[model samples]
Target: MSGLRQEIGQKAQAEGFSTPRFARLAHDLEQQARLRAFIAEGRHGDMAWMAETEERRGSPLSLWPEAKSAIVLAHSYGQEFDPLERLQDKQSGVIASYALNRDYHLLVKGKLKRLGQWLSHRAKTKVKVFLDTAPVMEKPLAQKAGLGWQGKHTNLVSRELGSWFFIGTIFTTAEIEPDAPEQDHCGSCRACLDICPTAAFPAPYQLDARRCISYLTIEHEGHIAPEFRVAMGNRIYGCDDCLAVCPWNKFAAAASDARLLARDALTSPPLSQLLELDDAAFRALFTASPVKRSGRNRFLRNVLIAAGNSGDTALVPKVTALLSDPSPLVRAMAVWALSRLTAKPEFAALRNDLMNSEADMDVRREWETA
Candidate 1:
């Protein structure tokens, strides 16, 4: 690395980025092809924005022609414990490690801007920074920059930082020498694939987002399909099965920032308590957290699914209360949860008492199906 490049990387490290490297933006037809195929097949599921932004997202040059080099930075949010271990405790919800605390976009975007402003002033060029909010293909670019290789689970995994990291990018007009891309080290390991609760991966390196728990619980807006609910277990926000099972995670360490640690209540949250969250309470609890973006209704929907899978009779009252919820999404899942926890005679009596009052077609279907 050049002295200037090394200096910028050192600055990024000070900003809490664990890995930083340079990549010259150039045409990569293969990455574009894969993106096209993913959208063409409709594997992106309910996220219509992926199809809308396909052209700009296809290539770095297409997004910003003036940008010659990108400083790809990886910020680690490595989990302190094995997140998968919490799954056995079905009464509690397993939140993805990344969403355990504050939104990473706020933290990472601040760090990227700090690094970008410094580089722009020193190099006398315009710079643009991006967090996960953009359509940019960060993982591929991170691989090109030698920060990490895209593991079979499709998350960038660094030799130093493992897979528990978020990517930030600073595209600049100033030309910087590019680092050689990292080669894949995921050889012969299918741990990420075998451990998936929903069998989301069709093959190594390919993900059908429709089956992905993270997408189903977060990006997906409507009612989650019945097929995946039982498989979902108690994962209320996002799933970490594949990421947690990676062999490279052995090198991972806890996040350096104190703010990244999960809140006491958020860690293995009781499904019954989560099911009781009103809009105001939910907003208050997840104020700066990524889970807030899911909105109260959709989040409650996921929590109800966890409640349904919990088989804990103690949560019955909480689940029953949601039957009259304004959100059809929540009401539907509440019906499902009641069925899972209550016996046929009891559920039938409750349904008989309330079914006629329910107007939403989807929620009615859930009532009928249950």
Candidate 2:
């Protein structure tokens, strides 16, 4: 152990990162293979960026050959309320626990930058920090650093902290003894697999991003597949069905960062009000939040899908108003919503009103089916 390592660990603990560990920059060939198979199978779906940076993602050495060690940090953003509590209200959409407040990338990056400066000052080494934005495979790196094992759900999980945390990485040209990776304790429990609304897990320890609602509403930019809409229920934002079902979360701590606490309006907002938000209002509501990254059109597209699944005829008028939205993707989803809302009689009237006049071919086809 080096004097620099001990000093940095004390500083990190004082800075609020729950646990910090150091790991040498070595590629885990097995995890890299799994990530390759995942992307090659097209499980990443429309998230092309995952494939674009394969080299850096597979090995930290490729990201920066001079990097001698990777410092992995974990921050628990646990919930005060049972996140599942919001799901019972069918009329109110459930936003994922992690996204209920401010974006983790921004929050964690700011802290990691401070940590990096501390490293440079103490060890006199060049350092680089990363959140989720970078190509580095953060979860695998964290596990290698003894932060925790990647749970069967493929998110890093710990016996002490469970799965309610975000992982950050700091790469530097400093030698630090690595910790042994933690063993997986997921065992025979399949709570996360059975709980998915879209059957996104082809098997345990894997995810088909196409069927994951988090991908559908966030990474996916176009109209959501019709068959999955009903299964989506009222989750207008990212889904947390898998994470909420994990029994390990019982050990998770309440978030100490005030910025991560769920805003009351977002906890279980009415589907109608969410659908009614215009672009300007949506920007105002989610300005610094992760939800804002999806942009208004993509979010409204999700809200329309939720409206269609809502089984509330009252929302049909609101959905109808978005048929002429500037984005064709939003317009197409509005057509799907109208189709789901109205029966044969009203459907016929809406079809006549929209079919031929719709400029988008996809919207026209959706209206024809409606």
User: Can you tell me which runs of candidate 2 are displaced by over 4 Å?
Assistant: none
**What tens-digit string does per-residue lDDT give for candidate 2 at 1-370?**
5677778788787767876888999767987898899899999999899999886788888889999999998887888888777767777788888988888888878889999998888788999999889898988888888888877678888877878888888999988888888778889999988989999999888899999999998889887887788888888788877887888878888778878888887888898888878889999889789999999999988888888777788888778888878888888888887777889788788787768887888777777665
On TM-score, the leading prediction is 1
lDDT of 1 by residue, 247-297 (tens): 898889999987787779888988878888999999999999999999999
Best by lDDT: 1
Prediction 2 TM-score vs. true: 0.96
Task: Report, for every candidate in turn, its global Cα lDDT versus the true structure.
Answer: 0.91, 0.85
Which pairs of residues have clashing backbones in candidate 2?
none
- Model 2, residue 227: C-alpha shift (Å): 1.8
TM-score per prediction, in order, is: 0.98, 0.96
Model 1 lDDT-worst window of ten: 1-10
Model 2 is weakest, by summed lDDT over 10 consecutive residues, at 361-370
Which residue pairs show collisions in model 1?
none
